[model samples]
Target: MADVVIIGGGITGLLSAHYLAAEGAVVTLVERGECFREASWAGGGILAPMHPWRYADSINELVFESESLYPALCEQLQEKTGIDCELQVSGMLQLALAPEDEILARQWCERRSRVCEVLDQAQLQNLNILSTQFSHALLMPETQQIRNPRLGKALLAALQTNPAVTLHTQTEVNVIETEPLRVVTDHGVVSAGKVLVCAGAWTSRLIAEYSSLQIKPVKGEMLLLKAEPGLLPYMLMCHGRYMIPRADGHILVGSTQQDSGFDKTLNVETAQLLQQHAQDVVPALEGAPVVRHWSGLRPATNDELPFVGSLPDRPDIYVCGGHFRNGLAMGPASALRIARQIVAS
Candidate 1:
């Protein structure tokens, strides 16, 4: 039996395994599908929350802590795994704001002591890639992003090389039994001293009898466009959708939130709508070829803040999930906290 059994292999699970192993705990990480194929690989990897001021302080606390940890984390991952996660400080430009939004943004920046510069349409036009239709825009110079897929690869490689971690891919966990702290899976039952569920959308189903944890699967679709490097120097967000530019001339235009349960089927109409949104913001991308289109499910909680603690009655069973759209931004800190709790116990 392993010291810890993690029931998911997404960012949360992988990071938790990384931390627990560092604390001399033997971890068994199980994944239903290939690791990182879910929301962890599908996300845009924005280091900051979409709008830091819009969310509760709890959400901001985890995200900012993870943001601060990313620089050193990515460096260590690359040093160990020989894979660059492409972590970069690409600023974010927010457009199409209301009068009150501008004021709120400024106030939030002041309170947080973060950079928030307001620019008019003319000043935005000077950037060349953005459409000059919006009255003003907010420039957040400290925002950072990573190539999520690359980050997944790097983390997986690091764990695979670690002696304290055991990985099981394509392993479906049917139920979790707390009396003996064992996981019933397709292959066989694995006993553990402690179990941590970072299963994302499938978290509620696994521990349905243990607690009433409601984690809904929110579907999000994205389109990838190939463009010239430096064409768009920063990430752009308007309404709820955004375009994230990569260091390698690939731009990600995403996404739409729909209550689609666990179904991941792609919709042609949805893709067209996403393309239209992308072209509307950057006219230069009007003729850009959409190289790829994909969809993933984000796990949303009732209170919007992630559940990062143990179950109500089960001290041996813990959870670090329901991060919704901010999973990548919050994964590091959430996993670190949960691992520390398990180790101390």
Candidate 2:
């Protein structure tokens, strides 16, 4: 039996396996599908929380720490695997905020010592891509983003090359036995000294009887549009929608929150609506051809905080899922914390 069995192969699971193996623990990671093909690949990879003041401090704690770790983590991943994750400080421009919201944003940034600038209508007009709909905006100059698909590829390569880690792709865990600490899967059974479930959207269903995490699949649909490089200089957000521009001029316009259960079918109308939203924010993208339309299930909780501890009466089994849309932002620190928790015990 391996020292640790990780169920799920998303960012959290892969990072946990990396940290555990680094701590001298043999890890067995099982994924129902290909590794890093789920939300980890579909996400825009914004490294900061969307609206920091809205979430609990616990969420920010993990997000900021993960943000700090990402530079070194991406550097090491590139050096070891020869894959560039494309981590960059794209920054963010939040427009169309209410007057009270602007005050709260400034107060929150002041408390956190975060660099923020309030741009008036005249200043906002200087942004070439922006529409005249928004008169004022808040600029977060320190926001960073990564090419998540590349990051996923890098992590998978790193884990595959690690001698202490074993990976099982296309393998689904059906039953988890606590007494013997074994997981019965599609292929066979895996026994481990400890089990860390980072299964994301599937976490609740997999451990429903043992855990009451209330994790549900919140469907998010996105559209990718082709634009000129540097057409949009910043990540733009307004009314809960965002446009994240890649270095290669692919702008990601997303997303709609539907309470759809495990449904990943693409909706043509929704994709069209997202395109309209993108054009509304940046007039230059008026006739931009949409390159791709995709959907990913975000693991959501009622309180917007992830479950990152052992289950009740099940010290040998731990959970680190239900991160909603912030999975990419908070994944690394959460993985490191859980790995340390398991190792210390």
lDDT of each: 0.91, 0.91
The true-versus-predicted C-alpha distance at residue 137 of model 1, in Å, is 0.9
Model 1 / residue 200 / CA error / Å? 0.3
What are the per-residue Cα lDDT tens digits for candidate 2 across 231-342? Answer: 9889988988999999999999988889989999999999989998888888999999989999999999878789888998788989999899899999999999999999
lDDT of 2 at 213: 74
Model 1, position 142, has a per-residue lDDT of: 93
Off by over 4 Å in 2: none
RMSD of each: 0.9, 0.9
Best by lDDT: 1
Q: Write the per-residue lDDT of candidate 1 for residues 103-206, one digit (tens) a residue.
A: 88889999989999888879888888777677779999999999999999999999999999999999999999867789999989999999999999889988
Give residue 247's lDDT in candidate 2 (0 to 100). Answer: 91
lDDT, residue 186, model 1: 98
TM-score of 1: 0.98
